[model samples]
Target: MSINKTNRSSLRYQSIKNDGYIMERLEELAKQNPVEGFWKCYGRIRNSGTIVNHKKLHRLYKKMGLPLRRKIKKRLPARVKEPLAVPAYFTQTWSIDFYE
Candidate 1:
């Protein structure tokens, strides 16, 4: 999900200008109080009626060389296959394939 680029630019700069100090302070608080998720921190700031744009915020994070923590993808556990013994020292062997 994403906001339109024009909308983001319009809102982001306006938000920065209107609440630059608050945005900066939020950054400081994020540093000092280190939240587990950066997006969550952004949400907190958004709740403050500030105009901070996600694209701009992300751009700054990129500029500062900060890594965004990606959520680990959940995977189903692998199914365990039972071992089978085949008899074929010198004898002919037959194999079969079945479709489900």
Candidate 2:
């Protein structure tokens, strides 16, 4: 009860300092793309030759309130209208003009 192997196994050395460079880079990217979430940012960092842990980026992303993507509305297609052939003379045009 006083001591256990499980507790001993869980213990591990932790880094005393975090690289401010990664944090600063992440913040800058987030500013540029406010909706970019952890995974995307992590991918960018990796692509840029930075190997920061994803979990750390996730925590920081949440802390900074950045999301993966924004909800953008899809653009609607325009309606196509056919050109009307107007008759120059009133007698030339005839219809069951119920609407008019």
Candidate 3:
């Protein structure tokens, strides 16, 4: 291995910090607002004075499986077909056009 001994030793001794606090906060927000997406949750956390980076928050959010479900648009009902009535007289339907 061509790696520096000091760098390898530091990497071996590095400890990972617990992110439980942020995860709990995110889960709480999700429970309170199930319809809102990640950005809304991020905004709420930011407003509460937590300065978490968006990318980190997103990663944590994904890790916790908190993605919002996409809503499907409702299909419009089919329009009723109506038969057009023919005028018996020529003046039965009058149209006026104004030129500007």
Candidate 4:
């Protein structure tokens, strides 16, 4: 049995300290947005001047149980009923409001 040069590549290093921070933040954001992505959080953190490697964040994100985003269809707009002309008779006119 032998290993080829191509099979052996540069080792990926992960930081336990950074993983803790990343995991904490990932869980916090996940609570707010159930389908949040590491790349999105990476961009936000970078934009806030807290720049870090995307690869590291990606790894930490997975370790914290975050996954890829899923497609969700937006809800349709509600239909509104038009107001009808009021009848002169008191018994003939009835109004209902869901707010009540």
Candidate 5:
């Protein structure tokens, strides 16, 4: 089966319209919840009575560049290297042994 050019163009137009509406909704959700990730946005949309497929939603989510930035872990300051303290006399150190 083959589709004529007009029909193909019409279908494309309809798809574009639908995509535009979904994109707008996604953008609005993103704006309202800037820190929320894609799944949260998808859940909000789903809870709003819109039955969008997760795959499609993910595609649009990625297409709109709406992925949340990952938080970086804070690094602790470097410690000063110090020489290990050694007992001058063997009697100064104590050793413990454990037995089961």
Candidate 6:
């Protein structure tokens, strides 16, 4: 068995593979829904049969300059107060006196 050196021509640097279709799909979805973020995009692509890494997706998302919409807090409307109903009969209404 003899030691052999690897050829220099085969040594080439390749750039990271980025699918244009995925980028386009993400761009379309991002435009359609600007408020949603990584997880949402991840789910959308995953459901659409495209599995992507979260980090890569986020990196690309930032690279594409997609802005996440601010979340607005949902508040319950103030309830309207109703007047207390008066008892029809004196016996029907029992009052309790408390000395606190």
Whole-model Cα lDDT of every candidate shown, in order: 0.64, 0.77, 0.91, 0.72, 0.87, 0.82
Among all windows of 10 consecutive residues in model 3, the one with the lowest summed lDDT is: 1-10
For model 2, residues 1-100, the per-residue Cα lDDT tens digits are 1365456535767667676787788888888887666777789999999877788878777676666666699999998988999889999987785773
Writing each residue's lDDT as its tens digit, candidate 4 over 1-22 gives 2365443334445555646665
Per the 3 Å backbone cut-off, how many clashing residue pairs does candidate 3 have?
0
- The numbered model that scores best in TM-score is 3
Evaluated at residue 19, the lDDT of candidate 6 is 72
* Tens-digit per-residue lDDT, 52-95, candidate 5: 89999999999989997889999999999999889999999989
* Ten residues in sequence with the least summed lDDT for candidate 2: 1-10
lDDT of 3 by residue, 1-100 (tens): 3355455555666689678989999999999999899999999999999889999999999999999788899999999999998899998997999999
Ten contiguous residues minimizing lDDT sum, candidate 5: 8-17
Backbone clashes for every candidate come to 0, 0, 0, 0, 0, 0
TM-score of each prediction: 0.42, 0.47, 0.65, 0.46, 0.57, 0.54
Clashing pairs in 3: none
CA displacement after TM-score superposition, residue 39 of candidate 6 (Å)? 1.7
* Ten residues in sequence with the least summed lDDT for candidate 1: 8-17
Give the per-residue lDDT digits (tens) of candidate 6, residues 1-100: 2245666655667688967878898898988887788678879998999878878888887788885867899999999999998999888988899998
**What stretches of model 2 exceed 4 Å from their correct place?**
1-14, 68-100
| Candidate 5 to native Cα RMSD, angstroms | 5.8
- Which of candidates 1 and 2 reaches a greater TM-score? 2
Error of 6 at 53 (Å): 0.8
